[model samples]
Target chain A: MRFSVLGVGTSFVESAMAETHGFADCDMNSQLLSPRLRRRMSSATRLALTAGERACADANVDVSSVPSVFASIAGEIKVTDTLCRNIAGRDFPLSPTQFHNSVHNTAAGYWSMVTKNKHAAQALGAGENTWVMGLLESCCQLRSLTDKVLLICYEEAAPEPLVMGEQISDCAVAMLLGIPSDKKRSVCIYQQRVEHAGASTELWSPVSAALALAKAVRHPQNSSKLPISSTAHGWYAEVVHGE
Target chain B: MKQLSQSIPITAYSAVTACGLGNTPLYMALESGKNCLQPLELFHIDIPTCVGEVREVLPEISESLRRFDTRNARLALATLNCEKGSVRHAVMHAIEQYGADRIGVVIGTSTSGMYETELAYEYFRDKQHMPESFDFLNQHAWGATADYLKYELGLSGPAYAISTACSSSSKAIASAQRLIASGVCDAVLAGGVDSLCRLTLYGFSSLELLSEKPCTPLDKNRQGINLGEGGALLLLEKPDSQHADRPHLLGCGESSDAYHMTAPHPDGLGAQQAMHIALTQAGLSTKEIDYVNLHATGTVMNDASEMKAIKAIFQSGVKCSGTKGITGHTLGAAGAIESIISLLALECGMMPGTAGLTEADTAFQYDVMGASETTASVRTVMSNNFGFGGNNASLIFGQYADNG
Candidate 1:
């Protein structure tokens, strides 16, 4: 089964660095989100919900109606750092809210809470290949279980002073993937084995690969083969546009 | 889309926990009904809560894969190389049956290298930067454990990590089943690994969900959860002519509570939906399940909601119990560890009971086994794991006949 890109919600990605060989800026919509909940949200959760709301709105589907799959490289890196610092100090005064938000699915959980979406949701991490793996997972669900699935890939900026702080930046990309029904941009993905990951030297987040997919959705007339990001084990995705 | 009924056979499975190194130790502890939880020693905690530490000395990761070293990787490596484990043999066999490229790795973990990162942060406290030894990509990333498994096993087909809090591994198994069903992977090594770290211990403590002693999951006097560390792996493959006597993963149903960030729905509406969906997908009635391994964490709200959901579905009174009282709450690995327990119940025809449950909660009418049942004829089992995001997943397993 191929996925028809029903909607593409990508905002706040550094496309100059994320684009494959050639990618591109974001439009985040937050009017639907509650300000109280949004204020307390971690960066990852905020970005995911922003993109998720946009994707659902673009697809003309209620956010609560569809199951979601969230992908990330390092989820809530800042929150993790804060909690780590707290524990190392033996403060014993850690915030319960911070502890609850430390889960890798922080974004997925918050999205569910705000939208009241009880549909099955998943959060995943695959290092560099997180974007494609999320796609693989979403594809599996669309093929066997659900007709439509919301896939969101997000990453918060790495904690400062750490080496990763320089390599990683904030980015969130969401796609509403469904079975081929409309004339929307449809793509079929297959796995490929490699000696080294495609973007190994850059340590690219799934944001780049997802940004490339977002670019594809915008200009489907290009109809060129797109190479998604690769995993640490040299696993990558080869996306073929469905006519 | 109830394709979960396709029946994916578990070719082989193994688990390493505070109980011991392999399935034997886990089963023995269950049969002996020993409380494996002990005084917290892995890390210094001000609280008096107990912890389930893998007392066994873990093997060191190979030098080639040294960069991916962490307690979580150690836990996963212990399972991978356990002497009594069937994974080493089964994975090699799968490589021969299906090219190494056809077999996938789907591992679940909540905090993959968070403990190591915590230590690295301590280094940052003094050095201004993390130690030169700290490798973020290999050591601290959430997918590190899964990559370590893929590299160690030398198998590569769509590998990734699922980290949906407590339901991580069960969801990983469910995804593996779908991968095989989707024809992308012929066989998949699926399970989860989680190590006790200050993050979860202190994290749960901050929530006031940590019990000062051994946790009683379904008892009226139940306090809270005792953090634990361990991992379990089950190799699931498309059914073949062989291994029919083995237990097969029949169906998986997943849902979100959408009620709150940390608390479950008041009546466990999502939990009930997950159970109903799983039963419908498996094409079985509540009475068909021989037993249930609840996601009972020994917390007041969690236990009540889960029990209410259970009663709503299994009103006829199917056998049920919580095993976390023995192993403590393994967090991300809870799903896989408990799944192995359920599979063991089906294969060994023995039901492991709630270890810390001294007295059953008076509110719930269904009996939560307080002692292991040595004599039982079990044909099917249901395992439930609910996590922080209100993520609820239920898995059904049963024996499948082989074509000789």
Candidate 2:
């Protein structure tokens, strides 16, 4: 089995539910979303689409042909807060737009809907291992149905008081997978199970799957296997090592 | 396509709805031809619209689930209670009976813990204070419901939440069947659950899709949709000698319209693709489908487009019905809940009527069964769910053990 990392896109952190800043700004991590649409959407939707679009652009792949898999641990927490409040208030009414945006896959759904890509798309949420699971599912789907897949993993900043002092970072990463061609940049997904992280928790944290993946693609190590801790519980980390 | 044979099948099933609990009651009510919809009374529904609110109440959580006060937690715990215990308990029984660690749990939900998290934020806003009980990891994420199930049940294999709006839970079951077929999980617990929240009401109202009176799916005089909430659970196992009683999850197809963010393509192109995919994957032509559980929510765009999609896919005289008229569109849980209804149809070999559907929108071509049961072989059935942002999924299920 052969696959390659085709393209990648990302989003810098934005405050909860705030409009994403323009991509050209020094922080170029985020992209501007139309005010008309942003007013009706949640931050999670904005961040996911922004990063997804960039990744598609990087891979030079048309969004229409590429199947997409969105992996998010926590999606649209701010919307969750608002919906919960309305329910508890008993007299408060729910917003239709907010309700639509509140759905978990709204981010990925928006990406597909906006891009007008009728291809396969899915939104998956797991625990810490969400990124890893997302990668695995993306690979499996790509291998099963089509020749290529675009996997976008993102975590939006949770609304205040929701994180409960949990050290959370807002990050988004996209990877394009397909049968590797000699002329194209490629990587092979090597699956393995390891017991522990070699370094400190801060450096070897499970959420660092993105960093490891980025590093593996950026600087290919001699070893063909990379070990990762599970982002979700009880699951082992997998390494995608290639030359 | 490698001549895809040996499709997945739905075996055993159960559900809870505003109509009532259990297959027998729901089936009885559907057969009685009485509308189960009522005003949104579960939470002081401030929006003043009708809802298919499941007849449930705040539950007394077990010592194990006391900390999970989010709406998803409440629904999960209540659903488990309805089934007798935690998912682990249920799966253990299936495993002991069926004999396999290859068991998997796939669930679909939309609001999830948002209802609880909103309450926590409201605590800070209304009382001008925050609560210590508010845990972000537990209540505010999309995966909270699935994660809670995994933890509570100790499910070690593949587990995740499918968040495709109304079609979510249904997709979970479909995906579980794929994994099981691919030899990922043996037996699977598949379904979806969601609770009512004010945000949903106000949100739909803003879109002008909410109805003041009961929704009428195919009625020319239809006003709008009446949103509802509930949960359904089904136990799916790979057919074997030990398990001769369950239904089989035949096949499934998923597609996105990518046409509009909120509004479905006027032509129902995405919906057409979804239905087509399911039919093709099941390796059955349109003629083979005994009945269809349409995603007819009564909204003008959704109904018209879905009808168009249905007409384009099925033959001129294919039998189909929209049960949402009885259940009141369960949003993310619709797919899973409706699948149970489809399974029920296969179990009894009777098709439930399209409740509240008075006038067949003459524009639709297929035979729309309303307010009655249509008895047929029901060897193959298709269920459709289209979500916001163009996400659409279709599942096909066949009667279990059809050697006779």
Please name the candidate that would achieve the greatest lDDT relative to the true structure: 1
Comparing only chain B with the true structure, the TM-scores of all models are 0.97, 0.92
DockQ scores for all predicted structures: 0.73, 0.46
In model 1, residue pairs whose N, Cα or C atoms come closer than 3 Å (at least 3 residues apart or on different chains), thus clashing, are A11-A26, A19-A23
lDDT for each residue of candidate 1 in A5-74, tens digit (9 for 90 to 100): 8887865534464443242445343655777876787767877888888888889998889999999888
Model 1 TM-score, 2 decimals: 0.95
Model 2 captures what fraction of native contacts?
Answer: 0.62
Each model's TM-score, in the order given? Answer: 0.95, 0.87
Report per-candidate TM-score of chain A alone: 0.85, 0.77
Model 1: per-residue lDDT, tens digit, B241-352?
6867678888889999988888999788989998998888788888888889999999999999999999999998988889888898999999999999998998898998
